[model samples]
Target chain A: MEQRRSFLKMIGLSVLGTIIGRAIIGREMLWLMLSKLTKVQAAEAPKQYGMVIDLRRCIGCHACSMACKLENNQPTGLVDGELETPNRRINWSIVLGREDGEQEKGKYPLLSKRFLPRTCMHCIDPPCTKVCPVDATYRRPEDGIVVVNYDRCIGCRYCMSACPYGARYFNWKKPDLGRPENPQVPVRPVGVVEKCTFCKHRIERGLEPACVETCLGRARIFGELSDPNSKVSKLIRERGAFRLLEDYDTKPSWYYLPW
Target chain B: MTNIEDVILNQLTKTTKRFYAFIGALLVMVAWGAFAWSIQLTRGLAVTGMNIPVYWGVYISNFVFLIGISHAGIAISAAVRLLRLELYRPLTRMAELLTIISLMLAAMNIVFDLGRPDRVLNMVFFADLSSPLVWDFISVSTYFILSTAYLFLGMREDLSRLADRLPGRRWLYKALSAGWSGSEQQRFGQERVLRWMAIIILPVMVSVHTTVAWIFGLQIAKPIWHESGLGPYFVTGAIVSGISMVTVIAWILRRLLGWGKFFTLEIFRGLGNFLRAVLLIYAYFMIAEQVTIRYGGESASLEVLEFYSTGAYAPYFWSFVILGTVIPFLILCIPRTRSIGGIVLASILVTVFMWVKRVIIIIPALMHPVLPPGIGMSTGIYAPTWVEWSILGGSYALGALLYTIFMKFFPIIDLEIGK
Candidate 1:
């Protein structure tokens, strides 16, 4: 038994040594790769556009989500063909109901309900883009918006696994646009990943996203975040906005002004 | 003329009516699975029960499981070479065949999991080297090629001996043997090559499973998969499940083919003891993995751990513990239950439960809500459809069929005439 313990001790030490050794080597390799990549990307400095949502003005009406679906040609019903369950539907702009503190404490309702509208954060170092084995998803250098090349996407769903925000959605089946199709956005084929593109098609046409344009409460704000004069930047400066899951280091373009 | 040759050849040349029936059943399954894949190809991934949050299910689970199973062969074969255990000589070729067949099935499982099988070529045309999936692809393919080469190289002496005796398959044997005349120089070259290949294979096998683990482990997005310990944890699981699988296969072959004299009690006993030690180590890893998540203050990992322990996944979690590890460990540990039959039974339990273990690993981590506690973003849970189940069953049958065909064509057990 004593001999077995010593043997196990030896093996553990060796394994620990190997892990530490590999980590050091791996760090060095990562540094070298980052250096080389930064030099190549430095040629074209891109504009970083972002959004800021002030929760104080939101009414939980889901107007932004509807506008997004109308603009993007997303399917109306659940892909599984379930009824009245909008949660399982292809929603590019999801409006979630949030509550603060303990629930069910005294019948008078201590907790307050808040509506949180979630769109693609369009992260600067997007996890989805980083893990796409086929480079189908990429962050455009012209603007900081992450986009998916539908033609190149093999739909391996590795990006879905890597995404912290759960923003990416797969085209599970052929899309059925309930309303008349919007001419601006191209309908994505089945078997490719689709997400909120910050309405890149509209952005290129010098128009704000449909969600921002159609917000009944005017809670959504969008502009060039890197520019100090932009509305998003002004809001961030005035309200001290924060990104969701910031600890993940995704550097999301979207921010929220908490009440 | 030799006793070894006569006995092995007799089994190789003959087959029962049951063998044909078994092959026929497997072929029908393969055809049905191919039809199911076509349906999936025409329709999208919605055909499967996968939805938001639970996007991966049985396909990915089976992929990881088969990859783990493949490790048994090369790991054992390489260990035998390193330790100079002549007792394992008879089992080496069978193990190598298992590795090759399982790997092929694992790759196919990946194809089944893909939303667009046609665009698979895009993985190569525009590859992202930083992605762990790319690392998985590169390592697994490299392992496959090396194992195939190693298997053939090890079989050269046997192939040469059988080339003249098997007159109908002479050309195939001759081509495979690579014109070996059994000279001393040729023998020396084979030894040197085999030794180097064995050395190379060991690390490659380790890296292959580690890379597969990294596909999940590198993701900080999911709390359950993003542990630094996952790499070693997966490797340990692979070795444990692999040895258990090999034990089952070896026992079945011994009983059915009447190769009991060649296999011997000592060989099964050695394998059983080795399996027991590996089980102990795996149990230690499982405990360490659980303790770190359960006791640690990381809320995200804690939520996942809680989910596994007492929430929706509790049934699979507890069953995996009792049947997969604990019971098997006890059975293999006790001298009374350490017989050949006992070991085979334990192996069967471990093998099935390891697969169940993988399904447990993939689902709960994914099902956990990505949003913070306050936000209610409920999504559907995964339940694999008939298409998935059919394809999974077909994949295992295909692997067994391949093994059976290979056994018929070649002398899987080494003669040990020259060695």
Candidate 2:
């Protein structure tokens, strides 16, 4: 009788221990889930900023690219009147020109040319932010704007490899801005990766991004993408715009209107 | 029978002129590498050939190769112990020592590749769990600690035995032995602990290589790198490279230390056959990976495939297959050519070309981006600068130096196996 009672007591203790462990673990898991859910909810709070580029109106002039460079105080690739290699330069916004013979429109004699103005798409589910080892890059929860914490970056460049659009650039050397520095924008140090931030500073101050503001063709539009009545949202809903690499399902906030 | 203990003790005590020359050469290479690194630190990574698109280059490839080589311990020592393969008993210490040295070198390569080496500690303070790089850091560090402990514990008995005999290094041995007297109770406890460590280390080894693979595989940006089979592929490749390294090291030790009796022809043949089998499995994975990409016919992945098979990188890709896999396989397969010298030669080729394989894995993927480069953008050219090469050479010399120094102080072959 005594032996049986001891065995029963042992089983009771183990069961009680298991229950307590389960309760604690379950509570922690619940807290984690709740915290993640709240972050998602906050991200979806209808203030998500985005951009739309109407390719039909684009003239391939590269005014916006120049504006971005000047605004960001980016290196110009010119050193002692000798142009540095393209890889050595940093351009947050670039106009990619696809020349004739690549995509012939009607026949061999007639060829079509297309100009693609590329920048950081600022995706809702960003691959670059996900791959940062130091949590240096992240999508802001409030406005869904992706940003990089330059101070925290270890400059491993995993984010550079993770970006599908090739939007990110690394500061290989010290910035040699021949022009005066932009006091509004902090110059990135050598060795850290930098990218287009959708002009987070300008947007926060109710000013449009330099690229959008300086676009001579009026091709670029910036507004709240989540708001149904916003210009970018209306352009997407009405004109059937497409995001680049749609098959990847990154859910990029930036869209382009077909020519 | 030859007294193995006396032979090892003699090797430890005696310092030959040739050994000093070898160590001297290694130190010079190390110094050159340090000089190159100093230049890089002052100027920046711009001194290296890594440009806009090809942000990673030889350093990353060397990092992966060294990590793969570090698996020698897991493949030879721990697995041999678990399987009770007594033929490989003499090789366990050498393999473990290689693991420690190569792992340290591999980690240094990461530091070398970093843009901001000063901010490396930020990885710990601001670690992001979602990143595959963090996973790799965690797993590699865990494996390093565990393997170091495992190696130390396995050497405890030998250290205790050497403590009494070697007066000059008595304190060092005594401290390392940790009061081990080889008693019945202590032996039992030690055996149990080592057994548990061996078993536990296997998974950590698998996790280490798997996480390394995920560093590329998890990226949806690079279609060629984003493969489900990458984990298993990298692990199998690591084992093949690791075993090849052990074979090469065993051959060197036999030639230099005159330990031909300990590392006999049978051991070489066994290793050769084992390497052949793993190489075949690795070939299967390679075929499967290529076939899946070709059949799927995705534009980006096919571009990457074409880049390997017929595009700009075709030479490297074909050479890796023919030299690293085919010739080695054939050498290991033919019984007549499976002699000790032939096996060693084949191992050297495999070891060298495995590094080339890692290069093929990294560079080609970056060269072929999903979106083509714009008109004014870089054409994605990469060539490692003198600085990069110097640093790489230095790392290899450093590894050799560490291995040689350790062998001078301790037994390269386990002393208590047959006893």
| DockQ value of candidate 1 | 0.41
Using TM-score, give the best candidate's number: 2
Candidate 1 structure, TM-score to reference? 0.91
* B301-406 per-residue lDDT for model 1 (tens digits): 8888888878888988999999988898899889999888988999999999999999988888888756742145555477888888988888888888899899
- Which candidate number has the best DockQ? 2
The residue ranges of model 2 lying beyond 4 angstroms of the native Cα positions read A1-42, A80-84, A99-112
Mind giving the per-residue lDDT tens digits that candidate 2 earns over B11-78? 99999999999999999999999999999887778889988799899999998888899887765787
Could you give candidate 2's per-residue lDDT for residues A31-122 as a string of tens digits? 66446322232246447899999998888788998899888878766651232467767888987654534633455466545678999899
Candidate 1 stretches with Cα past 4 Å from truth are A1-45, A78-88, A98-112, B372-377, B417-419
Collision count of model 1:
0
Per-residue lDDT value at B12 in model 2: 97
TM-scores, in order shown? 0.91, 0.94
